[model samples]
Target: MTQQSAAATPMSKEMQDCVQACMACHSICEETMSSCLRMGGQAPAQIMGALMDCADITRMCADMMMRRSPLAAEMCAMCARACDLCAEACAAMPDDAQMTRCAEACHRCAESCRAMASAMM
Candidate 1:
């Protein structure tokens, strides 16, 4: 509750990993969204929506961790789900390099966030 207590509590490795993953996912999703749009035909409404959602959630999850919010765990959980959805959407276009990279990042972030959420529980 107090800043002292919060500061005294060291961050766990899993939490740190999740934070890093979320940040990375955020950047990837954002860049991928633009890249997808530029690619034209491949950027369907569903895929675009997934990229945007993934970017938003990853940013939220990272911010929650940085601020040491009590809701960080819940945010991580939500982020994991979003990342999974994004991964699925990206993976649908196996031939596209950008989509493949985004899918991989999403998968990594999803796994890390899932671990972080479980640890919080």
Candidate 2:
């Protein structure tokens, strides 16, 4: 396995980091939802919601993969799309640095989820 792939394998360094990243993103999105509301008024609702959902699903996907569940791959695939959408939503607003951070986190989670899904299949 290439260093990259091997690192992300279940218990490897990549997986651990990916899990932490996913968790952080999830927490940030959740925490930022209310803050985004205060910051952006009603403008950030859709994107913030998407980000929250994406973070949640991404975390779940990672957990499932860690357990070697039969549905892990499918969950990860779905999460990849969700994270991609979240990134796009966040990208729509470049002015918000927090959204940018959320976007980057979602992108990283999506990449790792995609790899995990592929490996499962």
Q: Could you give the C-alpha RMSD of every candidate to the true structure, in order shown? A: 1.5, 5.6
Q: Per-residue lDDT of 1-121 in model 2, one digit per residue for the tens?
A: 6645644655757656656666766776666576777765654668867977886786787676566566767887888788888888988888878778878877887887777668767
Off by over 4 Å in 2: 1-10
Taking all chains together, the TM-score of candidate 2 against the true structure is: 0.78
* Candidate 2 clashing pairs, residues 3+ apart or interchain: none
lDDT by residue (tens digit), candidate 1, 9-120: 8777887888899989999989988887777746888999999999999999988887778888899899999999999999998998889999999999999999888887
Best by the TM-score measure: 1
Report lDDT per candidate. 0.89, 0.74
- Where model 1 places Cα greater than 4 Å from the true spot, the runs are 1-4
Quote the positional error of residue 107 for candidate 2 in Å: 0.8
Model 1 global lDDT (CA atoms, 0 to 1): 0.89
